[model samples]
Target: MRSTSQRSVVIIGGGISGLASAALLARDGYDVDLVEARDGFGGRAGRWERDGFRFDTGPSWYLMPEVFDHFFHLLGTSAAEQLDLERLIPGYRIFFEGHADPLDISASATENMERFEAVEAGAGHRLERYLDSAQRTYDIAVERFLYTSFDSARPFLSAEVVRRGPRLMQLLLEPLESFVARRFHDPRLRQILGYPAVFLGSSPGRTPSLYHLMSSLDLTGGVQYPHGGFAALIDAMVDLARAAGARLHAGTAATRIVTAPGGPGRARATARGVQVRDPAGEERTLDADVVVATADLHHVETTMLPRPLQTYPESWWRRRTSSPGGVLVMLGIRGELPQLPHHTLLFTRDWSANFGAIADGRVPSPASTYVCKPSATDSSVAPPGHENLFLLVPAPADPALGHGGEDGAGSSAVERIADEAIEQLGRWAGVGDLSDRVVVRRTVGPADFRDDLGAWRGGILGPAHTLRQSAFFRAGNASRRVDSLYYAGSSTIPGIGLPMCLISAEVLLKRLRGDHSPSRLPTPMSPSPSHRPPPEGTIRS
Candidate 1:
């Protein structure tokens, strides 16, 4: 067993994955230093505040409680201890086109089953059968696959996996849309079951049926909100990382990934450190035993490192498919929106056409949208008389689409989309004066995503988890051409979402320690700072 006490790790990017990696490594006796170009943490999960209204700018839904629990458990704590969580009674509500009434999905499975039965006579049984398979697959994924880096097949060769191999393979090969369509006669049910694929940064028709496990998280376990917006969650995460002795540097950008030669004939390069520019625009070197790049993988590989040291370079990125970009409209309304739940999804009747529009690089006219009224749950987010709303409208990941503006002040494409979405939400949700009630308005579009987060193709999420891009086919955590350099985040192995980001960090840890066990890492005894700090000497360019 090698001692990690003397080793230093430099993490580029202070997103969820980067922060998680810091917490893990810092607790494991490695001196960890994390740097973020942004002024604060959370990356896409960041927040915005104005006019006494605070909005969680990204990732509203708090699903997959088990993943959250496991990640916190690894840190010798629990999600219950770190977060003040309140589960929504009716997980979420869905509004269909031309349907005056909305369909409410409850936290109870039996109640949800009855809700499905009301829609279609035989749909309840079908949903039960569907959920049974989904739950089993979900269990299997959490236990066997999510934590494994897929560096090899060793982690998945268990006896249980072998017995379930055929069914699992069938799921991986089939499309989620087809699977849902075959079981439910109603399009609403189909939309309800299939919409989860979008959370994986993929369309139902393109994503594998194996991802149907997403339903088990929200539809069954129910959806929750962490009392104060996601910003509070970010604060907790920063606290955890800091408590574990990891140092986070905000407004610090990594200019280059410094590499040293290694292997026979110096064939491969070893990561020696990172070159960074501080908020003051001063350059320095962070000499490290390991470099974990948790930024957009494409950005780190294509721009930060030299061509010779790159594994997945510009050409490889050109062939990869990114998830949809999104336009986020944040509104502060002068009263309660009682009609809308904590989470509401408006699904267009012609789902395929809506997806097709995005595929064709055009915004859907009557786009399917998701709305989150956090004020319904947390009063602290908005002023006493106002409510805060966050809406996500998926669009083509094209930066040329333009950026967001305050109060729809700019005559840009982003504001146009925001205006249309306002009208769309008003009509569908039966709120005639929705636009009139807006006290404050802001929009975040594809170009905003690109400029703010370095999103690949302005994507809000990472790559799509399609058949050819899921599981083992997904890019691994480590660089093939760079020793001791690792990747973690939505763009890398294990896929998207906040839970998946935590799992991605665990995968990075596993790869570093040569641990192939699929079980979660046990909590360490009294997690103390186990290493000395790295030198602070600045390196001139």
Candidate 2:
């Protein structure tokens, strides 16, 4: 591998952020190596295959096309060339608990507006206004907030932001639930707009209205999927990282963060490298000039680093709010499910009780759930005659709730949730004989996230996006205690979701290069090392 720069970097975790960071640094001439505990890469964007059936076991939604595009551009590639992308029309279907027909939300702004009009008298026009405000804030955020190190208050206190300070502050202070409820009287309409806060790992009641920026994604930007599942995207990222001269070690668990010698305290001490336990259980060390940890921040802080060297200690985390964990059920069915779309949401009418139960650490009976039927768009996910279904039920961040298993092989509590979800789908979504059609089944609970991913509180996403945990208030990218030790992932700044993870890596690049500008990168470093794939449609957050 080329090592002309002499400066070497060791990245922990092989997730999106970790891999992206590795690819960017390696392309910049740093000798880089990344290690992951899991046997494969992609972290939460994992994949599973069986009997010619494949599943994107982790993230299903490909939101924020610009972030993905820019990230690939930085790596001397373009998303259009690196992978085949499909923009999902009528992006998703929403099925109410008692409604006979489902509401389809599409990429076309006019089509979605008409659907909104049909739901409520003036909601269509109101939605237009809502999205306008959301887009404005989103643009501002993309420019001034998402790509920064937060090294100073200048980004937030800029003349542009200060001019809009009162309005932005009002949005920040109000809860999302209140914001949506006031504008849209129809519960379905409100739920449609507010549900995104759930994926960000918090209920609308707790998340700030500023997150209305999320509306601009599906409502305006639409949803996207990469053919061959997310695994194909992961494969491309791995390929790029490898081409850029980065070494990847799977099944290698990093046990500790080694630091410079002769340091009496963590302050001002440089990171030496990472101490890891390999597949054979043999311990070894990988030396580095700098270390970037893109794993779950809680795991790296509480488990990988020694007491004094940890920037966020156990006590610090105790006081912070983490996002909700989830119950994930994957099923392979025996026949076509034309009644279902690629993306669907089953929202209960009484979401106040539904989401409240989750926030209070209880399972919402008839809980609001997200269902992904990727087979509608990708033929690679299942056998020719069969369909694939993945279910997500928002649950409390408690691992003791139980683990998942094939069929009902795991915890009774966890299985019960999965069982109820199946029945709910059959009842609300009219998917008759749903249970009988399941030829393959697997359920993942909070414990699996903890055991498999080292997720804090077994959270599916990292920290919750509460007003207190938003933006600069969130955990930083660099270690405040240890020099040369940095972090990039869902748990760190820029917050949750796949797009945020990509931006987090760019933020890390800025931090390392001592370029703290929050604006978009002026230009790609070099010509792309890829052939462009023809577009199926324009693409996401």
Candidate 3:
């Protein structure tokens, strides 16, 4: 048995949240170690460079700059020190068919509303009131709600949540369509207000209004990007973690978890260590004082731990409203897209029918698609006279829709769905010659997300943020059944998005350190020489 004096921690998964946790822990002076299944860090924020064209294939948008700033500031540094951040002028653009001009959403809400009023009449005032309510929701959510682990709504079961909660409720119970209808008479204006929620991968009618929090992040905090692309932010955090004394192991996958006794019950089982498979198919074991899983909770529950270590039954997960998965096309256009901005959102006329298909377990037809042209702000991303484009469409984790079906990515049905998406995007972008101008093209769908991101059924943001599943009602940050086992990332509390991921990491760190304790953790400079994965058999390759 390992001695208690050998205090060390092992983190499974090296995504933004995992890396953040490692940075905080190591900086606090604890003996920390991180393991990743991939060859590099950043996870979903990982990037790929080919032929001098850099693409941040995942998480193309950066809404809340303050989150990154706070992360670095906590570490006695600033994100600006390691990354060059560019603030986008027109935050994003919205393209609708037959409209003489596209609307540009910028940091100046008054100006944006004035432009909307000019097109739709009286839209400016209505937008003012609408944003006022959204601002309240954002204030309360960030200040009071987002920081804690919400395993239950008991904490919010008060008059405050009852009153302000309805503000959240107005966003939650009412479909965004109804919310917009109440505010605007113009179809175009309504479409603009309702369109952003498409990122949730559900129609405004099905998706709750509360998700309007997205707008607050953009309009209030503003959108910013790292000069090198989103990947630079991840690399910055990784550097901070390493500097703080955290040990990272890349291309290492955790296969099994060993737990303490409870006679096959979750409450008594504490995570002790893990079995890892390396690139060469060799397996090794390592023990630790604590285990934090930034991996998908469903994956960890079903695949890594014994059945007894699971917090909730598989039936619960199967019945939950899993969020939408998607297909992302990364392209290096040979020529510049003069009309496109840093970010552009293209809306399909029928979003309700589109999301309805997904909710009913069908691939969306004529779905809304988002296009991002990062090179508009960061010149270094593309070679001279070129543009980097990323197009994303919300689909489903359903196996039926893999890569147009013939190539056999996963499901033939999913493939067909992807093919349809490719076709539709070509039409919407008005790029009739997309197949010709494309210098480089790569596609990623639900299947790739499932395999690479460890997403459960490729649900990118875990369970949907429905009224029943949101807030403290979402999964707890700390596993109730497992001892010394904690969770961080989009799957756990604070829900999805880069900002929330960082907050979740901070919450986990707080829980690990103590109950609101302010003292720094003592650093163990030299780990015991004998403490190593057994030298006997080969580790998983």
The digit string of per-residue lDDT tens for model 3 on 126-216 reads 7777787777777667656776655345546667677775466556678778877887887778887776565553456666787766666
How well does candidate 2 score on lDDT at residue 526? 43
Query: Candidate 1 residues 186-246, lDDT tens each?
Result: 8989999999889988899999999998888777788999998888778888999998778
Runs in model 1 deviating more than 4 A are 1-5, 265-267, 524-541
- lDDT, residue 435, model 3: 56
Give the Cα lDDT of each candidate. 0.88, 0.88, 0.73
Listed in order, each prediction's TM-score against the native is 0.96, 0.95, 0.88
The reply for model 2, stretches above 4 Å from the true place, is 1-5, 261-268, 526-541
Query: lDDT of candidate 1?
Result: 0.88
Query: Any idea what lDDT model 2 has?
Result: 0.88
TM-score of candidate 2 on Cα atoms, chains taken together? 0.95
Q: Specify the poorest-scoring 10-residue window by lDDT in model 2.
A: 532-541
lDDT (tens digit, per residue) of candidate 2 on 1-541: 3233356789999999999998887776666889999999999999887776788878999988989999888876799999999999769999997777799999977788899999899998999999999999999989899999898776677799989889889999999999999999988999998898887888899899999998998898799999998999899999999987778999999999998743665475679899999999999999887899999999999988788778899999999887888899999999998889899999899988987788789998988899999999998889999999999998999998899998789799999999999998888877779999999999999999999999999989989999889988899999987888999999999999889998998888778777777886655754122312113232100
The RMSD (Cα, Å) of candidate 2 is 5.6
- Off-target runs (Cα >4 Å) in candidate 3 are 1-6, 98-100, 151-172, 200-202, 262-266, 403-430, 516-541
Minimal lDDT window, size 10, model 3: 518-527
